[model samples]
Target: MPGAREELIAHITEKAVFHGDFILTSGKQASFYVDLRRVSLDHRVAPLIGQVMLDLIAGVPGVSAVGGLTMGADPIAAAILHQGAARGVPLDAFVVRKEPKDHGRGRQVEGPDVAGRRVIVVEDTSTTGGSPLKAIAALEKVGAEIAAVAVVVDRATGAREVIEAAGYPYLAALDLADLGLEA
Candidate 1:
């Protein structure tokens, strides 16, 4: 049997990859698209994603929480939180809204307080890296030390370069090649 990461890759390739013309969040055109939500939200695949992503961010030290921009990172963070607990890792999850709420404490970052804690920003897939960077900005305001930026699928666009150029370590569990696709 394949290991968790390999199994997760198989699931993504079989279920999430779509061919033909597509437009990405980055406003770029592509011949293929990786819709990780298709599998990331699946019952069976969620745990696999949790396991694979846990392994992906394992090396980053002092990580107390995982999260990113709300919509895409929501399920991914939940997966990691559950899987990390199952493995005795004791991880927490947070959410970064696109804008601070006008009501109810007027806060942007939600969940347990991340102040003075280390966090790894996560996303379902990365194209231009805007989502993670936006999350990072909010996290920083709340005093969360960003250990790294991680993604389940990297489209091999300029995201890595953009994140790394901004001085955060960029970690990706799978790339286009792993899904038998190309940039």
Candidate 2:
């Protein structure tokens, strides 16, 4: 969480990026947007974002892996894998597809098999908590012993309760206030 959190947030803010004012995937409205893929694709920002997340979950016990829905969670998985491997934590990763890939493999979850694995679902943002919940369902279906759900930003929504009600812990590296960007 060291350099990555500060530097990555700075990059996102300085970009002054816009993705159009439209309904969010969670049906929420906002004056701004986070083009996560754009930021995640940044050669520098992506790895740091992943490292921040790894540090966010480092204290959590029984966490055998890190992962979540694709697109939002893709770079996160890769970053965690790289950091974990480097640190000898053996943190595996899995992807919970938006829908099962209908093509070859016919797979929904990708990466280390989650069956009975202690895992953590990661997300870049949380508005209504829908995305993380969907990933949770996918992991549960595969017998994944999910330890928790973590996000880089919480957006001050009720995502924490939603995840807690499902009997999994929730963590956020920063809330809207932390970056002085909250409405």
Candidate 3:
């Protein structure tokens, strides 16, 4: 049987990896993109993503929740919470909007109470780490202690440096190298 990492990678490789000239969220031009939303939203791969992400944070201490910027982080956070529940971990999940809502509460971070809890921020694919960093800032504003930044794929450009420079550990399940793409 394939290991969890292998299985997740296989699924991502098969379904999510894309090759094309595209402009990324960062406004940088890239020859390829790893669009994980396709796999993350799939019933088959979502649980696997959760399991793998759960494993990524299992050894870390005091992680009461998982969350990140909306869209990229949504499915991953939900999957982690679901898997955590099944395993008796009971983690809460949340989303950080790109901007605080203009209406009721005007909240940027939404979900269960996260104040005073350690959090793991999830991202689907990271290039410069802006999405996770935005999530981190929003979470921190509400007093959420960031434990780590976890991503499904790292483009291996400047994301690691940006994330680490901000004082949090970073982890990626896969990267451009894994998909045989140039950084």
Candidate 4:
């Protein structure tokens, strides 16, 4: 049997990868798209994603929480939180809204107080690195020290360069080759 990471890759390749023309969040055109939600939200695949991602971010030290821009990052953070607990890692998860809520506390970063804590921004997949960058900005406003940016699948389309150029270490669990795709 394949290990957690390999199994997760298989799941993603089989269920998440879609071919043909597609427009990515980065406003770039692509021949293929990796819709991780197709498997990230699945019960069987979620745990696999959590395990694989945990291993991917193990090198980064002092990560108290994990999260990123809403929608894409939501499930990935939840998976890490649950799986980390199972492994006794004790990781908290947060959500970064595109914009601050107008009501209640009018907050943007939701969940535990990440203020002054180290966090790893996560996403299901990365294209141009815009989403994680946006999340990093919100996290900075709340005083969260970003340890790194982690993604499940990297399209190999300059996201790594964009993120590293912005001064954050970028980590990816899988890439286009791992999914039998190309940039």
- Please give the TM-score that candidate 4 achieves against the real structure: 0.98
The reply for model 3, stretches above 4 Å from the true place, is none
If both were scored by lDDT, which would come out higher, candidate 2 or candidate 4? 4
lDDT of 4 by residue, 69-142 (tens): 99999999999999999999989999999999999999999999999999999999888899999999999999
TM-score of each: 0.98, 0.87, 0.94, 0.98
Q: Show where candidate 1 strays beyond 4 Å.
A: none
lDDT of 2 by residue, 1-183 (tens): 447688867776666235456566667776666566677667887777777888889999888888898878777777878878877878888788999889999878988788988899998777777888899888888799888899876767678888888788999876766555654
Candidate 4 versus truth, CA RMSD in Å, comes to 0.8
Ranking of all candidate structures by their TM-score, best first:
1, 4, 3, 2
In model 2, which residue pairs have backbone atoms overlapping below 3 Å? none
Residue 89 Cα positional deviation in candidate 3, in Å, after optimal superposition: 1.4
**Residue pairs whose backbone atoms clash in candidate 4:** none
Please give, for residues 109-137, the per-residue lDDT of candidate 1 as tens digits. Answer: 99999999999999998889999999999
Model 2 TM-score on a 0 to 1 scale: 0.87
TM-score of 3: 0.94
Lowest lDDT 10-residue stretch of candidate 2:
13-22
